[model samples]
Target: EGDGAHGGFPADGVHRTSRLTAPPPVPPRSRLPRPRRGPLAIVVAVLLVLGVGTGVWYINSGQFTKVPPLLSKTEAQARDRLDEAGLDVGKVKHAYSDTVERGKVISTDPGVGDRIRKNDSVSLTVSDGPDTVKLPDVSGYRLDKARELLEDEGLEPGMVTKAFSGEVAKGFVISSKPGSGTTVRAGSAVALVVSKGSPVDVPDVTGDDPEDAKAELAEAGLKVRIADERVNSEYDSGQVARQTPDPGGRAAEGDTVTLTLSKGPRMIEVPDVVGDSVDDAKRKLEDAGFNVDEDRGLLGLFGDTVEKQSVDGGDTAPEGSTIKITIR
Candidate 1:
């Protein structure tokens, strides 16, 4: 064939080769738009499922029991009973009561014959019995006043006994058995010791030997002593010359009486203090070795002058003697 062509085609001009190329690949699935589950949608679906489960549990988990009457039962017993019945112990309150004993159950919250859910706490109210009060100090107070004091302390007066007491006045309380500042239950009895008038009476015992005199005075409920200074008297020496209050005189029991034994004479001349002012009379008698005592009559009370003397002027007596003067 000729090398030239009319359509300008190379016709086996030089041994040239043409090869076919591959087409473009398909797009990946990851590059296209995709459906999504956001945080809000996920949360809402989870909550809905949880709510349905909770409602089912709430409707089916209810188990109830009747609260048995725990009235008057001890706290331990009540707690044990409640626990056995699948219940819990709630608030425990205390109150004072007159009818119920102490440390006992008085009442209950939610009451008796009420239905309560299992593991529910039941309230308990316990009693403390009657209230307590401090024992008052009624010593030295009059009986009537002491009763009032006991009443004020919310206590009851127990026993009243009468006794003679030198320290406590008549018609007054000497002491209480439990004493003061003691705490006791309300309406508790308190034993009392009340005073009754004077103590005792003293008898006469004079002119006896010192030892013998003491014995006699002891029998008569009186105390005896010997004077420091002896005197000369008609009685024999070493014998009691005279005793205080003379003889057959009234003296308080256990009162000491001084016995002046004879040791020759030691007489003193009495001084006249009558018709003088009380101050002047006392001074004059004391200067003359005499003890001055006074007695004011009903009409002569608060008087400043002495009206009469126990011993007249110029009379003889013991050097140290008591001279009573009536004031007017």
Candidate 2:
């Protein structure tokens, strides 16, 4: 009661009641959670925008693209390159080449370094190999026809030779150099062989010895065919009497020349040479195929006429048999 403001006691001298301690007031900044620090939303947004821009650039970058050079590239490689550039592969063809290797690309249709649209097809020309060809079967063909065939096969006619061939016709090819089915470079030379027909000229061999006749016939490209049946003729025994095909006739090469050899004069009848002049008797005896022996010891001293004969007339004797005629 004495201190009403400081204590709860009333002002009066009545009883005062004592109470527990009062709670203190909390500070304004103490209840908040701990502040967190991480990457900014703005930075994340910038990264997202950059990624989208790059993807767009990559997906749509083929409209104004130029064709890539593809010369000398393999077919597979060229196809891959075209695919990478968003282009298509076109028709493929093969051609022989001299400088380009086989199984390699020789060139392109639109060519390298040309401007083209994306997705457009590019034609490809592949190399087969060097320009080469296989020789054809021109043997036995006509000369002119063989030449034509050679030309058609991309070959050239080189040397031409003529020869005798029994199996091939005249003016026809007998054989060919490099033969048939042989591979060679284009425009290469091919030698030709031509036939010279079959017939040959038979030489004149009459009156020649058998050995000489054989040599002559051989020189003329002919063979000999001596006949077994000999003939009686003016030619001496073992001499050529006659020949078939005559002299200076034509015959095939390797043909046999038939020849008839002589066996001297044949047997004949003796003529009546008696009572004839000496010259007349000689002529008569010779004509009758007989050798005349004159006995002029007694008759020949008196006259120039034949007096007697050794063999009677109309008698057969050896053609070359000797006969005696007494002449005066």
Candidate 3:
């Protein structure tokens, strides 16, 4: 009976220990107080949502726009369109165009339907209709003055031709190609016809006495001027050596003719070439300021030696006189 009692006591002790070691019952989860969402709180929440949406929209679409169709629109109209598209007007340029009307938009920088940032600038090319000007009347104007007028009118001066005109003074414009008051493209070259005053035949005065030459030129209704310097020529000293506009060239009636007087032929020593080769003799004579004339007799047709010379060695003759050499 004692054993049974001891065993029962141990069993009871184990039961108690089990009860002590058991975990405590979990308390009911306390519920947070129901948030009292007032009008202000609701509005704040709504604003936060809206801000996020706006940020997304701005990043994706709000910051960008497309260029509008602006071709052929007037500048004022284009500006208005750009403003409506939330864009700024950039550089405005003008260019000549044959197809586009004047003062209208010829093209745009970004082009129509091109994507660009909102408020970005767009360049515009405005049209200035076909560049043209009326041909000006420059007749009777001096050549230099006429050219200036052409440039001022946006035209280029072209080929110039001269003709004798009794009415038009020398060095003056007679007329212009395409005539006056004709509409032509800007920068078009305009040819001009200049006048050479009533023509006068220049008289031949070379080899004549200076006074006689001057009187003869004056009788042709021309003025005469003597040159300040004299030149060596075939003419005798104190005679007119040359006249210009020379004998055949025509000149204006009142034009001046300049006469150069001669100082007579220059004397030079003849070179000795009698025993030299034909080529050597010719070279030596020419180097001495004398022209060489070959006299190859039948016997000397193929000969290379110079057998004789017209002028003897050590003699003096006109510098330009011909030196005849006989080859044998």
Candidate 4:
């Protein structure tokens, strides 16, 4: 009725509705445009991919693989297996063991069932056979027989030396080098010293001149005697009388030869000097190489004249002897 005149009241038609008081036109409700999630969806998808990749890498790595056990296998066989599995073989050290064979594997570093990564190495202990054998006592045995025995024992016969031994018989072993009962590896050499026999003598020359005697004895492959005795004879005066390793006896070479010697002329007393001029007496006795003690002085019946001597006149004396004289 009102707007029918303006539409009813025209000019001041219904006081204008307050714009501030009217609720904003309800936003058009086109169903929220489907959420545009391009960046967010991409971020979530990347996270999922990373997680799956980590899981796959871990499974394919050897870190998660089980190592095989190989204690009973031969060294060669074990080495081949390790190589095939992308593992390496380390150095091999040898040791003596009663339960292991000469060249077989004694044991492994990580043992039978240890876990290890690829390209890792496993050390090995190999067998060098039982400890060395003790050499048997073989000295005094025949050389040929000893050699056979050594050969049977897997040892060698080294150099053989010939010697004359009193303790061991000829053609028999006297002793061995490297000694007996010493530990040695198979095929090791043993040196030998064999006895030839006891030595023998040549001859005896006890009455010959020293120089001549040495020559004669040497010529006969014998030795000489050296002896001392009293003698008046000129020929072979102080020479050997007896010998040993007697003339026909046996002895070693370089054996000592003994002998006796002759003691020269015995001494006698000097003659008396009474009534003889002291100077003349001195000259005579001194010319004979005698030692003289003089007693002549200026106080006697025959002043400075020799009156008495140690021994009477005409007494025998050694050619070169000492004499004492008393003068008045």
- Predicted model with the maximum lDDT: 3
* Tens digit of per-residue lDDT, candidate 4, span 1-328: 5435565344655665555667678877687768787988998899899879888876676353334564546678778978887778888888886667777778887765676777888888778777676677678799899888888887888899887677777788888877888888776788889876566554665566567657766765455556444453222446544555566666555455665543433455455567888888887777655678876556654666788887666786654456788878
The lDDT of each candidate is 0.82, 0.84, 0.92, 0.70
Residues 5-33 of candidate 2 have per-residue lDDT tens digits of 44654566578568889789776776688
lDDT of 2: 0.84
Colliding pairs, model 1? 231-263, 232-264
How do all the candidates rank in terms of lDDT, highest first?
A: 3, 2, 1, 4
Which wins on lDDT, candidate 1 or candidate 4? 1
Misplaced by over 4 Å in model 2 are 1-63, 130-133, 152-154, 164-169, 185-187, 197-328
TM-score of every model versus the real structure: 0.36, 0.39, 0.55, 0.31
Clashing pairs in 3: none
Error of 2 at 52 (Å): 22
lDDT of 1 by residue, 31-102 (tens): 667769899999999999999998887676646677888989999999998999899999999999888888
Count of backbone clashes, every candidate in sequence: 2, 7, 0, 22
After aligning candidate 4 to the native by TM-score, how far in Å is the CA of 224 from where it should be?
52
**By TM-score, who's the top model here?**
3
